[model samples]
Target chain A: MTRPDPESRRNPPGAHLGAGGSAYAFLFFPMAILTVFVLAPTIIGLGLSFFEWKGGPLWTGAGGWNLPTFVGLQHYRSLLSDPDIRHGLINTIAFVVGSVPISVLVAFVLAVAVNSPWFRGKALVRTLLFMPTIVSIVAVGFVWRWVLNDSAGILNWFLSLLGYNDPPNWLADGYWPLFWIVVVQIWRQIGFCLVLYLAALQAVSPSLYEAAAIDGATRLGSVRHITWPMVAPMTAFLMVTGVISALQVFDLVFIMTGENETRYTTVLNLEIFREFSYGSFGYAAAIGVLIFVITIAATALQLAAFGTRHPKAAGRAAK
Target chain B: MSREHRRRAANTFNRPPFAVRLASHIVVYTVAATMLIPFLWMVLTSLKTSGEANTPPSLSNLLPATPQWSNYATAWNVGGHVSLLDFYINSFMVAAITTVLAVAHNALAGFAFSKMRFRGKAPLFWATLLTMMLPAQVFFIFAYVLCSWIGYIDNIQALVVPFLASGFGVFYMRQAVTAVPDDLIDAGRVDGMHSFDIFWTIVRPIVWPGITALAIFTFMNSWNSFFWPLLVVDSMKMKTLPLAVADLASAAYFTDYPTTMAAATLLVLPLVILFFFMQRAFTQGIAMTGLKE
Candidate 1:
């Protein structure tokens, strides 16, 4: 038995459906763009993290890529030891972990509620749920910052009416900065999650619910057993995407948290921003690399345990 | 399955169901209000004078006491270097060019992936999906890099280039293409149509609506895009709506409420209008993607 050439089989020169080899170039566009924008830059980014780049133009290399300089372990060392980066990592994790569950659960309940007849003006409700999702994050963050302002802000004004003297220093205190960031993140995201959950719940078969009802399940019971399992894939997707987004959560955090200080409100993106803003390209890139590593590890662990929305064999097996 | 279970089920669902439903109505309405109030605030605030804006937002101020329509004009003209018209021009041109290129590339590649027997096709598609999972984090420098390499960074193309062949577009369009009957291609061939002709004259229209939805999404994303433009293009001359509006808001010392409102309202109105018109296509197109793939 002759072994087929694996290389030729995979690359079959100028391969096509019928016109053979004529369509081979079609692959080049998508593949080339990927190489240029994604693969090549990523490889370059991996290398640059080791060097000390004085951010000017990427090519001019104000320069530092050496071994004692290469300190095979130094980039990793700096990433771990940096207080701001460390705080950012923790904040990012907390933000994701905190938001994902609340958003997903609230959204799921809202979707189920909307799917029922008791919810009148469903159209208006849906539009309301979707508005924040469509609005720019900057707008949402900025507006909410005003509303959540410590003194003379809307929340505090209400608190004053309630006879409270003080409200939280939302963007100021180290603790509440983290708290406010989470609040904004969840506030902006809950609507989006609700929409996705609604869409998923819309796909749930009524027959299944009816069967659950006939089987003597309470409304809540059916929700727990029937609805929950059916929406698991979406829940998992929300979780994964939530985790992934939370890891890189930048915009609202940057805008809402105001600026970086000992507030420990900085995340990886902010850390990178600090580096880049101060012309510490390599150091920022190092932070980015760490983020990339964490993302991969986290996502892999998630996929291993939670079976993603990818309905292919891997997902099926994971389930 | 049992008599006891049946009795319990009947009692639970049948008892005070009207009251339960009424309570649900109140609960859902409150939840819905949470989502809707912000936009109501946006509209109300747009009508407000600078004085109203500093004070807490309230429904009583929903309609500005003395409605000032001039604020919109102020926003339009405040950044005199480029007016709303210029931003509109920039937005349309960028969105139009990006949508066309992205849809075209997606169509061709999606067609190939769906129909053609390419080497490593599965792996290639998988790689594309993987790219979608990669965070938008690393993209901070994509525009800058592409520009320095091609000297197009500050140019309008900077806004249009990097996203031209979107991964999700390809994934979606490929799902649409595979549903096209092979016999249709054979019939086209039997009618003496060229393959390119078949794709253009036959397949394009069938997928045109699907492509139209993709175009709108691409357009919206490109139109509202902030970060990439913030990094790549530094000049006020090339500002898109989001960038210009954000600048207007941030630069306002007294939080130039009226002008900023006008700019934001102008920027968002077209989208709101566009969304309403194509809302059905947009929703159906989105719905179909999940169903298909």
Candidate 2:
């Protein structure tokens, strides 16, 4: 709704001075940057994925138009055959499935709790819960890695005091590192989702709850019947964005599991980083394209699901 | 009805029971505390000695026996090869310049998209929106190639030039600009004010809060950014704070816990301070845009 309709706003020609020229002038720089850095690279990245190149010029020709280095579908075919790449892709999917739902659910619960009319310290709680989202991921990753250290970690030390003789290695043991990575990701994500949910929650009309109460609805009944449906748009938004981010997770996983090269914790972006570092440019671009395809597909699927159920909400989301 | 009576009528009658409210409070506080634990531990470890940092945690040993204030100094100048100060300077310069330029470019483009008529307006706006949705990962591979082609692989320009504009910034500012009343713009035009001048003097002030919010978000994002810097920055001299802190933590020769903690704390300190000062605008910025960097 904040987007003004361009067609309806057409004034008579020459009624506005400096409008036409300045519009182009204003758009020139950002659009140029986007065209070169974002638009062109995406097209080029797709092209690069089909060809084999290692850290240098694309082809041995006058312009890169010659098809000497072209290897059609080779990188994509290799991706299908490669075990490590498949595992990395599966890990990313699992990460998205594991983290996105839990984060959105937990954030909704917290937002609902803190948005209660009688809730004390709402602002304080909001501030505290939202802190982690704004901080440096590397710093937080290091702190968690230290706190979850096998022998010297505060977690194990706390576990020992609580009458447990053995606490599993959180970062080193099989599956535990992946599990903790998901947990840390959820911890980081809850705040942003919570803030969005809180904003959505505040916009709900109190009169609806009052009306439900008068109709013999309990607090739980009211929330289930009214509040849940109302925040569907926010939930949809959170899920799409959350899945997109969860699929591309790198910095935290890299920081936590880089020392061990844990197979379970390796996600798509990490694999992409590794390929790029190894000078496998075409293969890396192939993986990048895979991530893009998955991201677009997931976004489209969510929008379709939401559109069927909440058409207006889905329309907003499409923006 | 009196005003107070009207307000009382607006209150919902489905308030939870005392026990239920108490339980909800406990759950909320627990989650909030969970969010604070890592930060508190980071600060605590930074002040402790290496021996104390690695020591078993207990009620008595929670605080450092005597805070080692010098760990920060040690962390700042780790080895002849790596220095946190250099990383700090690199991060500040890049983030500051990027923030200023991004605000101007995004605002101007936002104004154009929102109010001005031009050729390719609809398609251009759609492309901008598409850029907002597309993950930055999609472009990284070829962006690297392009940067290298332009002879900027290891240069600081790699950090700033390609990233001087953002789809989110443009979109957010478009919303802000759209909210400005048409009368103000029309009046400025009547007085023969140029579009740029009107944007600067009239519209900018109206959306100053939004601008500040955008600026804060841009700064924090640039400061904390890792992936691009990781790709382009091959030398220690060009490393940003995130890269420097990650390197420091994972360095093969480095097992100094307190110093590592100190370095982590220093990396996170600026934004933490900035958040406390601009918490309102910052959170509002996130809520307004419904996006995170």
- Tell me the lDDT of model 2 at B40: 87
TM-score of the B chain in each candidate versus the native B chain: 0.86, 0.94
C-alpha positional error of residue B208 in candidate 2 after TM-score superposition, expressed in Å: 1.3
- Candidate 2's TM-score reads 0.93
Please give the lDDT score at residue A315 for candidate 2: 42
Q: Which one is best on DockQ?
A: 2
Model 1: residues >4 Å from true position, as ranges? A1-22, A55-71, A150-152, A157-165, A258-262, A308-319, B1-16, B56-62, B139-143, B253-255, B290-293
Off by over 4 Å in 2: A1-20, A57-68, A311-319, B1-7, B10-14, B252-254
Report the TM-score of the second chain of model 1 against its true counterpart. Answer: 0.86
Residues A1-319 of candidate 2: C-alpha lDDT, one tens digit per residue = 5654574367532246334587888889999999999988888778888887775554647665423268999999998988778878888898889889999999998888888767899989889988888888888888898888876778887789889968887887888988888899899899889999998987877767656766777777666667877889889899988888787888888888854555777888888888888988888888988898898899899989976878654343232
Q: Tens digit of lDDT per residue, candidate 2, span B1-293? A: 57565356545464578998999999999999989988888888889988887777888889999989999988888857667778899999999999999999999999888878777889999999888766667688878888887888778999999888999899999999999987788878778888888899989999999999999989988999988998898988888989888887788214688888888899888998999989899888888888886
Instruction: State the lDDT of candidate 1 residue by residue for B175-289, as single tens digits.
Output: 8877787657556756766556767876788887788877777877787777677767778888877777777766762465555555556767777777667766655555455
